[model samples]
Target chain A: MKGLDLNITIVGLGLIGGSYALALKELQPKKLYAVDKDEEAIKVGEEMGIIDKGFISPEIPLKESDLIIICIYPKDIKDFVKNNIDNFKLGSVITDVTGIKREFAEEINAGLRKDIDFVFGHPMAGREFTGVKYASKEIFKGANYIITPTERNKEESIKLIEDIAIGLGCKNVEKVTVEKHDEIIGFTSQLPHVIAVSLVNSDNLGVDVGKFTGDSYRDLTRIARINTKLWTELFMGNRENLINQIEEFEKNITDVKTALINKDMKSLSEILSKASKKREEMS
Target chain B: MKGLDLNITIVGLGLIGGSYALALKELQPKKLYAVDKDEEAIKVGEEMGIIDKGFISPEIPLKESDLIIICIYPKDIKDFVKNNIDNFKLGSVITDVTGIKREFAEEINAGLRKDIDFVFGHPMAGREFTGVKYASKEIFKGANYIITPTERNKEESIKLIEDIAIGLGCKNVEKVTVEKHDEIIGFTSQLPHVIAVSLVNSDNLGVDVGKFTGDSYRDLTRIARINTKLWTELFMGNRENLINQIEEFEKNITDVKTALINKDMKSLSEILSKASKKREEMS
Candidate 1:
């Protein structure tokens, strides 16, 4: 537990999982294993040396692993946890890299063996690009690692997860409740990606006009290339927060529209100025 | 005129105008004059060597200037053009560096003396940072310089402006109509800044969260640190196109929200995929 001598198992073998495997490898774990439903994904990870050992099944590599990390989509979390609940060893800890939390935290804690601690962790790092091929150890270099916990989680387990994040070279580590974590993410992460997708989809301009688009348009739509299937599940899982963020955004846009219709440059400028001020304060 | 012997007078010694002066200086113009109502801006430009001469008033400089480039806000274009219309020498050509055009084009063309020609130009390049101090001659390299024209503009004047842009090392010199130009700007330029400002403003989380924000958020809101007053005027001048863009964005956001609410990850993914494809096509 004090060092990389601990055995670790990563589930899912996709982008986030592959990235964790790579970072864990750098720490030189005593044994590293991975499991994914997709045979091709496991095969690819094996071929890329992204995982020391990998399998194409849901069975947890229970006895050999001191740490188990889940990196599946939100909908897949409950099923994975339910299936593997009996396999976790006593004193071993489990964590995940899913975006949404509260529901999963409740389900995992309620079902897990009381001796096996569960600490939920999410890395605020990703790319518009996806899959194992796009995964990298460097992605965590300047990213945030949020460790969310309920009253049921042991402080020791949370500390272990934080150490793992720090070992992976995460720039910042913070603690928050599952609900607070989701709300912060809904505002900063989920909402931004949602806005990006919409902005890109709405443009009806021809390719030539797009070619004329400067950096702003390109930046605004950078997340438009996201894995919608995964993101949609995350969005739906945290439906209320996503809806709240969208509602607030709708009101902001309505005010902008009103200013434009009235030809009120003064009002429009003031609004933009206010937004700019807030953005600056955040940055 | 064939080489760099031409005297170029840059009106409004701010970022765009200051940048123009710096680039024109590299071609080593015979002389470069800075004309601006903001006396401090002129003084800074002079101190930075962005201008050869800083004029507090327009009269003396306007009389001898061969080419005058107005780089003021869109709303100020008409008055700036009117005040200097009589001062332009016979056969001398004039151009502007405004964002939106149709109205400015009409107003300037109507007020110009019979012997002088005015061809509108917009350089589609900038950083979020502003003013003469941050201006760089290198910004024009590999950036676009768009030439906007109406039927009233003389062909010789268009050629002259194109020649100047080429000499300035602009990567692309495009000729577009005033109306079309404004519409394109509304999407590529105005809409991006608007989205950035809104995204930045929407977040309630302050500096800690900002530090954790990745490149995606930074890129999306890079333009939020804007010159609000100038943008306000640009929005007013191109109210039609800006409003249309805003409405288009609203519809797009609504579509994404509906997808999220329905829990249709496949459709959401498809939408994002389509957006990525469209964005890729945009160049």
Candidate 2:
């Protein structure tokens, strides 16, 4: 299907869904639609001209959409797919924007309609702010997009998703296995959130430490103002991989602490320099 | 001791020193002088009009200046003070911009010339990039300035430093004992660097994890491209307090890890919510 001729529908009009609607508008789909539980979100999205139409019920939009992007909570995805199994258009492409992918991919692939193409995707972009009101197309600009494709997916479906990711201003589109996706996301996405939360929680100073903070503290904890319910679900969903990543991080912290206890400046300097060199290579 | 009539000399023209010179220029000091072992740094400061004169030796400027700001490595501050003890003009105010303050304050207070007043101050601002070339006066704008005073410090000298801190555009000028300053800094400054370095070093995915990163990972590790030599000195000089802070942080990480391992969503949600609340309160 040609990108410009397809009808696209976004489910859940929160930050990610709303942002997808705004960004996908650039493709000028034949019709852009959104199905959100919140009437305010749908009204706002339509009023903002991000979507051509909005629906509180998914049955109508799902039947017409050539491409459907699911942007709800991870735990609710299975039910959304199961409940709407009969509503989806025949031969339509389905994608998701969830952080964890392994279990969802397995469950959805096994139970999904054989005529539908479910290509799992994760757009690695977000803001600390939540809701449709804060959504912007600019979040995906120069961001990474990951495609975790299963054997059930077709070549054309993956290509269609990659093309859309690029159209949304992604700088890189890399393919990985569902397992690889979960493990890497455990480190790159989930671990950073864990660390930021822990760092903020560890503050024991009676006085407001904010007055004494520099760029280091502020930058490090910028994401500590988190979405609690969503992140808890993300954390529990990928528990094993996240636990391993947390252990590795804790061991590294122990190494630094041991060096500090021994007053071993040589080991300390080596560790810091290695991290510095590695970080420099990243950019 | 009036601001307009006083001559100010900045010792050791690195990032902090160069920035002080640039910001202090707004006060239009009778003469702004800089002394540094790096002749090129002094030359650049003078050529950029951040300072009126550059000195390879501290003797001339130290003898004439009424207020002297020392900005050098933490380990070298003692030696610089000892060597330049006689060069300081009688009753001139002296200050420093080091991260750790307890040990330096004690040693300097016990051995300082009775006439010269040493008021220990730490400007809570820095960039990941180092040296005079990257220096800008804007770093201190709305930044925190901390003054840690001992019994040896004169009230007038502390007041003068506060005035300069405000003149340099610091949002807050806070006073604390040396012990309190070091303890709070260990939590606010050193612990964040330790966590950043550890987070970068903990990357075991083997693949280029950078491609998968979002704002959370990038923001948390921005300081991982650290000034190794200087930070090593800082981490070691404040070893005890830093170790305590690290242990506290490790405990919090363990709590999250345990919650994940147990699949206790209630505990996980509460932890994340508390952190979110605390972080929201910070801003």
Candidate 3:
């Protein structure tokens, strides 16, 4: 259970995986290993000293590691786990850093070996850039970490994951039900991405819109440069909650449009003031 | 029309005005004067050496200044210019930093003194914080500056404003028709604010959503702490264009929602990819 004494393996060494490997290196684990289909990423991780060793497949690393951290697209999680379930060492703890939880947790736990435990987690931190070369452990500093443990999860496994999250410099480690996690994330994460993408795609200005943009426009659309295949998986996996969030946002946009069209300055002012107050409260 | 020798007067000593005053100090104008009904802002401006003198009324300052920069709300531009019509120095150049332009330009030009030229402008720079105390000229460094010169504007007046914009550290000085200015600002500036306000207002999550948010949500909602009164005027002043922009954005959002509802991963991925490519081009 000691963080520094355990052997750790990271599956999928991209931005998140590379960052986790870099951060976990600080814990001084006995042996830090990584599995990535992209051999270049694994080679870079080893060169950067982020991982002690690298593997193209999980068979050998999974059997020796005491903890396995999977950092891959949400759609690939089930297949990855199901295909490698037998390779995982008995009594080892497993966790993931995907955006969605409920269904993935249920599917994985349904067929998971009783001796191996999977503690679901999500670290609320990332950059617009991709790849292992862009990865840094600093992204985790002061970030929020969430754990969604199902009924079958053990306290010891949850505690182990929490300890690692804290060791990675997370500011808050909160536990929420899988349903609540998805619902809140729908509002806080998915909705913002949807809005950013929509804003960018709504570009009708023929001129270089970048020249006319201020800080607000720049910041709002910063994430619009998204990873297509990955986000498609996420948007579809958490379909219902994300749709509800988008609809709620659409309703708000309608309210503003109506007030503007009717020249109801009073109503528009109130809406803006309420939003301003709410944003201040968040700070 | 030497930059350092001219007498400059900044009307309405709020965030934009105060920042302009501070930036203009670098030019070391012969005299820097600011007028604001908020006498406290004027006093602070004078004490901080941002302005050489302060005035409660524009009458006296307007009579002597060679350059006047009006940084007031969009709705007040006409009234301010009307009230001070006879006071402006003969052949002196005047400009403004309001978000909207077309109507204000026409209305002010209708009864404006022929000798005093009013060159319309909009600085593509701002902060969520307000008032003279929060103002910093650094906001203009690398920011865009737009000039919407009407038919009545003299070439010399437009050149003077452009020079000052460069002196103030603006990265680009673009000239566009008043109508074009409004159209572009609707998409670049106003639409982002509308989205930020709407996103913050659509808070259905009962939980403290801050803990669950990542950089994307924080960046997207940062401007939700808006100046409600000022934005109300800007939103209404540029009503039609902003409405069109919002409708366009809504259509894009609906595209995303429809794709999600039908579980059309390919279409959704295409939409996201298009947005991502457009955003990358902007960068």
Candidate 4:
């Protein structure tokens, strides 16, 4: 709510953290502190001037900071949060940039004290390309920031999260439950990547067809080049939504296969027509 | 085959036809001719020197050409071929630039007189943009040209078609049955378009998202803004393959959905991991 002069501590100086650091620099935070296990990341962040202060270890530095944003891989967030929760000052508002939520939410809700405002958030933008060096202050421009809040979260925490998103140059910010966020992303984002990867794999790309591919082949399989550890963890974390979205594709494809097998022109036309119309309407 | 001096004529002067005309001219065709119902297309092609002679109608010019390449919309090809088959010079090759084949192969093979060779070929290269102005002589660079030959066709005719593909600057020329060509394209090409159209149409594309789309999104969805009439006819023509491809997608997606619904983390991880590996192996 107030101007972001609040001391902001960002954990994990990866692409998201580095970008957040650079983004908040324009706002002139009272003090910006970054912590990461990777000294190289911290060193890069400092060299790039993404943050004012850096620490190699996870000690919650001077927890009186107004906000603490966790920017780490989804699987690591829980342990990192556990390590830092005790040192977070009593009134500090905490948030995260994790792709998945339920598990992280449960961990944070149960791990941290009630005095700390911890609302989970995800900024839905990034290249398959990763790391701090690739980080840009402008990457967040016009990207969506979804804030996951529960009844347990204080209203002020949600406001602070929204403010942080807006401060980071996010064009749109909306409040959503953890479940809703996971489900929507599964359909709109994560599942698409899965599909892309599957299509590319099935085509036996990387060797021959990769060079011959036109724009369509390239675009559809763009997300195939992923950070396996992070994605596998995310898929496992958001297992429910991922499975559902994949199922939707499966059912649609099966019906299509049946029509093809039967040589049912009408059904085939109707199917693509419906998909086309739906796609058009959504656009 | 003999330096392409066989009275080469192209019907429809859009990107494909115009490019083909330009390529033929470079090969020193006997008398390059262009016919299009669009008077503007004829004027433009003549002015651009893509073709030496231009005709506003197909009927009169169809009698003189030794080889006629139909570059019209798939829906219009049947009528165009039917009306012009009687006019085609005896012992000449009649080919098409349509993406779909089974339907075309059946009708053209059965309908045409025994003298003319009807070999269906498709050069898998195009831009989202269209028209004679967008036609590039270099569009076919490194692209695949599929020659769909039936058992009834002569090897000499196939060789002539192969030569045309090479002359167009395409190197990956392969002979495939109509069914196989449709099947392979249905998965590798058509499905990508469908996915792109769906993804693009999903929401009002923020200008920022558009800017951040990178090469992958651009490449994948390049065919999104398609020529609807042509694509519609192509889909119907190769209904079997299209349906099968769609079904494959459905199955893949369904597997994903089940993984999510049941929280089957292992299955989801394996699928994503395998898919990523598969894509990495591709070109």
Candidate 5:
């Protein structure tokens, strides 16, 4: 497992990036470079021995092995890649850990050097907390990793990414189209977070509400403790699909509301019963 | 705690009622009666030693119980109390464990004999599964017991109910107006359930969708496994407040949607930030 001697540079030392640094260490990469805008993150990475080299900015020297993993936020991704593409040699494999893929795939392809292989992927794993402090390789255990490869992605690059995902302890590695990736993610991740934020802020709640909170309330709002800047950028980047999902969700709830208003027990019961059956199947 | 020799009749041997029987057993009531339309529940309650006596129907003799707890569903409650009001002797404190109280409080008060006392109360605790088979005294652990007492309720009756709540191991006992109870529950309980059911049924969800589920998706849809008939009745009873809450939730989400559509990052971030802060406080 440790035979590969490729140099790996992980950009951004946030949760996902830091986890990768720890997990990829098992593969015994020849040289691992950790780059982040935060000086404290680099110091921590160096002290923790997760990095052979640390850089505080993207503009630093980037001559290394041919694998580059970008874990920056959605808005900065294109600019970061465009400015740093020259850091890698020709025939380099570049992948990113962003929630939205279609726009990123398009924008990155438009600006990336022709010889580079850029495959947009998302690791379907996260914690309710953020930062390098909370990052751990255990989070990837039994989690799925998705690769949305464009026409330009070569088989060798896809294999390299999949190998790293498996080395990180992801349970499943599935390949999907960029469009399909966004749609599935819109329903599963973004829509749920939107519901949580809205549900938590749905009322002019008071401090005393904690006394009345039930298990259901706590469970529903567990994800409401969010990172505003990161999620806001992701939402805007995936705005079209997320909005469509919200509309679909609202329509479904409205159907329930109308049935409830009319005291149409049959309709209400049928909807709830179907939901229960489906939920049972899923769980 | 077991020194009291009060006679207690718990009507409706469902989850809440059965749990109450087990919990109140700690107080050592002289005679504990478990009443249910299901003979199986009564037999189980007796065999489990949670009840000294069991009644299959409300038509049976009620005798001279100092306290009566009705844990029946919302629709049949008024009829059950109205039909059995003559069973209890004068000055019996009748409290209910129904979720909704505004209409039932008025109806029960109007129908009860002048000497009878009715204090509408709610135990903010439940399980996804139902019936006496699932009941446990431990469900009351860390749960809040709320009493929505009307002006007709005597001070002694409220104290008796509060005693039973503490006896049941409820962490806190709170007093709320019927109006306030309905409103708060509309947001905390009913609206969240509605969201769960809708989310589970939002689309023609495929069986394979489970592969994409994250902790957030699972948390948000945990209550989607629901009892259709019981929830339908409860929702209809609290229709006005529940519908209002749905509207408010929709409005809140719509604000998020508008912000996302306009790419107004500042507004979106602020909304998510406030929600995160509030969620942090509650948690």
Candidate 6:
């Protein structure tokens, strides 16, 4: 402990947190602190030797930490920051693994003691499964990490957070304003899920879609089975931007509807051709 | 060709037609006639030895065929049958690998010579590639074949069409009325394609989506790159039912929009959970 530079603490040892611990373990931090409401998670982390020690509460020696990373649900993000930001040492950086960044980043910065640095980044990788047992550091190997930094953020703090994302093996580490982060993700991520759910609920298809699906139905609805509680929060958190995306999609579909009704083969064919070409270019 | 039992002519030797010839080749048909506008395709079929003879037009030997299978676009079905149905030998059956059924079946049956039969069936198999070069008999090995029989379809004629479908290596040969076929496909097949196209056209997704997409966007948009001409016809041929299906989807999305705006987690969670459960149940 005499001369070691980094003291890292990981809070909430679920899929993301435990994966972060496994990733940070390779860095060989002087001390790794593990905190979770679920005691079993901490026990598993310590048993796996991914943590130097485990804590069930935030009231411990958090001020000693150089960096603290949070990986809980979006709903829990603010209260945890409010309760624990004071316990962190002055000028030390804190970041998160939350997928959405806008409101959370704003709230965290506004609520924090200005001396304590809070930088927000979202590692865009996940699995269908959850919990510490299912976590693996390899999830970050080719994944994206987007940092949403406001003007209030210090350059050094942002740099420190970006360095951690890079060291965690993220392939793309970039910065965006909180507004851009929500809008881009609304179109690419949230809207796709919204569309899938809508398509799945379109009908109680009498035929077992499983036995008879061609590539279309099967591929489009593959994400239909989703985490409801988590997604509800995520969707509700970004509803306005998502609804805006949905409206744009509705406009596209309306064009198709008009073409189909008018039997305007030229227009329909053009739209489809453009979409097909765009999809190819995307690849 | 003297004293041979079976004489088969495949009209429009595209992917499905070429694959059919390869599969039928094993049966050692006394004659396998290939008709396509692209004489290059006919030569390829002849060179590949998948066809006994190639024709640049459907004009030759429609009367000699024991069975003639059409593999052209759905838009060509009505005219092709009107001009050539009388040429087929008495009591012979003609079929198609067309994707949709009801209206085509009605029009062909109404226009056909009473002595000859045009039995409408859809081979539920395909590849992204087109033309005889891309055809494979193996595409039908585990694929579903739906035989949509109209009231005009004679029992003997329907049986002959089913025999051909089964012989081509279909795993399931299910029968439904033309009405049922359109309705079922409206939800399972057409709706999904519409959703994918709409989502792809939602925004000019400027990011290299292939780089950052996880399961949701990648899996959902796999079918966004579709055959424009063919799908447009399919969508047009079955527009009313597809529009109905789209309305059902619109309703579902409206429900989601309501839930999101109201911050009604209970309602939002219910919708997601039910969709997930239904997807699992379908599987």
- Order of the predicted models by DockQ, top scorer first: 3, 2, 5, 1, 6, 4
Query: After superposing candidate 3, which stretches have Cα over 4 Å from the reference?
Result: A1-3, B1-3
Fnat measured on candidate 3? 0.90
Q: Can you rank all candidates by TM-score, best first?
A: 2, 3, 1, 5, 6, 4
Interface RMSD of each: 1.8, 0.8, 0.8, 4.6, 1.5, 1.9
Q: TM-score of chain B only, all predictions? A: 0.94, 0.97, 0.97, 0.90, 0.94, 0.90
Error of 1 at A52 (Å): 3.7
Predicted candidate 3 versus true structure: per-residue lDDT over A79-118, tens digit per residue:
9989998999989999999898888888888989989889
Q: In candidate 1, what are the lDDT values of residues A1-283, reduced to their tens digit?
A: 2348687889888888999998888888888899888888888999999788887764557656888998888778788878777777777888998887887788778887877878888888888777898889998987888889878788878888898898898878888888888887887788888888888777776537644665677778878777867876788788789888888877777788798898776778889889767766763
Model-by-model DockQ, in order: 0.57, 0.84, 0.85, 0.27, 0.58, 0.47
Docking class of 4: acceptable
**Which parts of model 2 are misplaced by more than 4 Å?**
A1-3, B1-3
Better of 5 and 6 by TM-score: 5
In model 6, what lDDT does residue B226 have?
Answer: 80
- State the lDDT of candidate 1 residue by residue for B1-283, as single tens digits: 3457667788888888888988888777777898888888998998897788989788777787778888877777788778777777667778888888888788778877887778889877777777788888877776678898778778878988888887777777889888888888898888878777777666765437774566677777778888888888887888889889989988888887887778776777777778777766655
C-alpha-based local distance difference test score of model 4? 0.73
What is the per-residue lDDT of model 3 for residues B1-283, given as tens digits with 9 covering 90 to 100?
Answer: 2457899899999899999998999888999999998989988888888899999988999899999999988778788988888889998988999899888888888888888888988889998999999889998999999999888888988998898899999999999999999999999999999999999999889888888888988999999999998999999999999999999999999999999999999999999999999999884
Q: In DockQ terms, which candidate is top?
A: 3
Q: What is candidate 3's DockQ?
A: 0.85
Worst 10 residues of 2 chain B by lDDT: B1-10
Candidate 4 lDDT, tens digit per residue, A159-225?
8778777877787787767877777666566766777866764552222565345556766887887
Q: Can you write out model 5's per-residue Cα lDDT over B65-101, one digit (the tens) per residue?
A: 8788888888788888888878886688888888888
lDDT of 2 by residue, A1-283 (tens): 2357899999999999999998888888899999998999999998888999999999999999999999999988899999999999999999999999998789888889989999999999999889998999999999999999899889999999999999999999999999999999999999999999999999998998789898888888888889999999999989999999999999999999999999998999999999999998994
- Report the C-alpha displacement of residue B254, candidate 6, in angstroms: 1.3
Pairs that collide, model 5: none
Give per-residue CA lDDT, model 2, range B31-125, as digits (tens).
Answer: 99999999999888888889999999999999999999999887788898888889889999999998998887888777688899999999999
Give the alpha carbon lDDT tens digit for every residue of B1-283 in model 6: 1233678998888888999999888767788898887889999999988998999867665767888888889878788878776567777778887777788777777778877777788877877677888888898887778888776678987887777667777777878888888888888788877877877777664666655455577667767788998998899999998888888988898888888888888999999998888877774
